[model samples]
Target: MNRKIVEAANIAINNLLPTKSRSLYDIAYNRFKKWCAEKNVQLYSENVFLSYFSENAKNYKSSI
Candidate 1:
């Protein structure tokens, strides 16, 4: 699940941004990865994702 979540994350991110701007994706993704590790939740789990998003959506929104 962990590996699949990481692969899915990379694929989803790459699909959203051009290769030249991948550093932006990397920085954003790393923040998510950090968040998941800190929370000890499966990155791809729907329940955990919703919980995290509910709490942290504002943080991401403010950055963008």
Candidate 2:
């Protein structure tokens, strides 16, 4: 993967999940990757994340 993309993905995931939540984070990361794939969006794109959360927040019960 491109280093910037990798950095961005890591930062994005880490920002949402703490170190102690690794197991649950894996599920979320997988879901995020799958969502990005389904939407044809860059996995590391801020807009992609925004769109994902916007669309799924009701299902996920997120305050963001």
Please tell me which predicted candidate would have the highest lDDT against the true structure: 2
Worst 10 residues of 1 by lDDT: 55-64
Candidate lDDT (C-alpha), each: 0.80, 0.82
Per-candidate total of colliding backbone pairs: 0, 0
* lDDT, model 2: 0.82
- Over 4 Å off in model 2, which ranges? 1-20, 62-64
Listed per candidate, the RMSD to the true structure in angstroms reads: 7.1, 6.9
**Per-residue lDDT tens digits of candidate 2, residues 1-64?**
7999999999896788677898887998899888888878754767777888898867776457
Reference-based TM-score, model 2? 0.56
lDDT of 1 at 59: 59
